[model samples]
Target chain A: MHTVTVQVVRPIGDDIQKKAAERSAVLLLGCPQVPVQTSIALYLLSMLRKKGIKGIIAGNPAARRLVEVSDPDHHYVGEVIDIDRCVADLAEKKRDFSLCFAFIHNDAGVSYAATIGSLSGGSLVALIYGEHPEDVAETLTVPCEKIVVKATHNPMPLKNKIDEVLPWVVSNL
Target chain B: MGCLESLKYEILLKNASSKESGDFIRNHYDEVHEVEAGYKILDKHLIGIPPIAVGVEGDYVIFPYTKPCYGTFLVRVAVPEEVERLRKRSK
Candidate 1:
């Protein structure tokens, strides 16, 4: 696993409360069918934490475990949630997230990201990877931020993209 | 929960003939009715993800699941024990 640390920079004075209130994000993971999914998820979460954003990972049971097993020290992955329950919570308006970072590989993954973006009324960023990414991006009609990284077992490609886009992700959110 | 304790809940079997049971699952959980043949592409990819529920039939169980990325896939569960194990581990 790649070791990346986040430096939490808190704004001083009256802006502190507003920044604190805004320091929340959802780290959404697609099905952990591939090994890289887990790695990419952790990397994104770590970067988000560095930005002073609290992140909770939501995925299928297997996907959640991927993150857990990948991080024995419990440093990057702070919280893991069942995908269905998380969607239900979003649907019911129980948790209004500020942003959703969804790791997608296929069409279904695209749908999940769009749905979360729609439901939470937050910024939806589609971190699309895997085969035929262009086709997958074409299929996506829902308005969202799309970051494309082509890979299967390696997380480096996506990590580089995240480094470049993290600022944009935070600024747009 | 152990298998026996888990068995207390409903298991949607692979060859379950009861329309009522199918209807029950549909009504209760997030369901995607009739996944068209064209959409089987989505189903093919879903095999990699974890299922939401296990449907136990006479000798086997099928996975009854819905994902935000795709529709419902009531596919045969190849490894029920693994699914059960993962469920327990998650708990």
Candidate 2:
């Protein structure tokens, strides 16, 4: 069996989503790794961290900001995208990654992540509401699930998000 | 992460739960169609509707591929306005 480690994160608050988007957009300026609006990237980043996969982020200032949320210790920033490349590079290994987890606080972010996930392949997408999420289902063509999130409000708490969904991912993936 | 329903719908498609399938989809007609673009609530023609990957964000939904992909052909059920337009054009 082929197995690649990935992480899932959900920053469950409004301000965090906007900041993450703005931060990602800023990094996306000339970067080519992936779109800054890519919610899946953020979600996948978390998964990468959990499984201790080699990771690299496209070089950019915004990526630096995302480092603020993704890797506060700052060690993994440069390693982010490199990790995905390494795993994708090894697609012939055995079994590819099955699921990724993410925390979203808004509609725009959700669309970006899911769209990118679809582009990549069959990936899972989740949105963590901050108590009041905008209901915008008219735009999606992917299956969605609803789950509860508990937080002291760190927003996109990577490890925390994954633990909560591990059961579901294991069952589904 | 959030938008629990979107996650659940995605799960359903991946591993269909026969019991809660369209009934839940039907109950949330306005909401479902809004998120599930080109999706109508008629049971009779469900078989005809192509199964494209779908995901939802609150009330709005998104379909992945932009152009009509070659291998698959889906007869999407557009909203009433678009349906009317198609009807008018056909006649």
Where model 1 places Cα greater than 4 Å from the true spot, the runs are A1-18, B1-65, B68-71, B74-91
DockQ-based class of model 2:
incorrect
Candidate 1 residue pairs that clash: A108-B69, B12-B55, B13-B55, B13-B56
DockQ, candidate no. 2: 0.03
Poorest 10 consecutive residues by lDDT, candidate 1 chain A:
A106-115
lDDT by residue (A1-173, candidate 2, tens digit) is: 99988886666786654543332211111121222223434554555545433233432355335454655676434343322232223232322334433233333334333433433333444544443433433333345453334322344543355557654554443
Report lDDT per candidate: 0.63, 0.34
lDDT of 2 by residue, B1-91 (tens): 2322234322222222211333344444343322222222221101112232332234333222211111111123223443343234336
TM-score, one value per model? 0.63, 0.34
lDDT per residue as tens, model 1, A1-173 = 99999998765764865775577788888767756788878888888888778889888877887789889898988878887667667766778678888787764575566556656778888888886677767756667888887778887888888899889878775
RMSD after CA superposition, every candidate: 12.5, 17.6
Could you tell me the lDDT of residue A93 within candidate 2? Answer: 38
On residues B2-61, what C-alpha lDDT tens digit does candidate 1 reach at each position?
333234233343323123334544565442233211111212212212222333343334
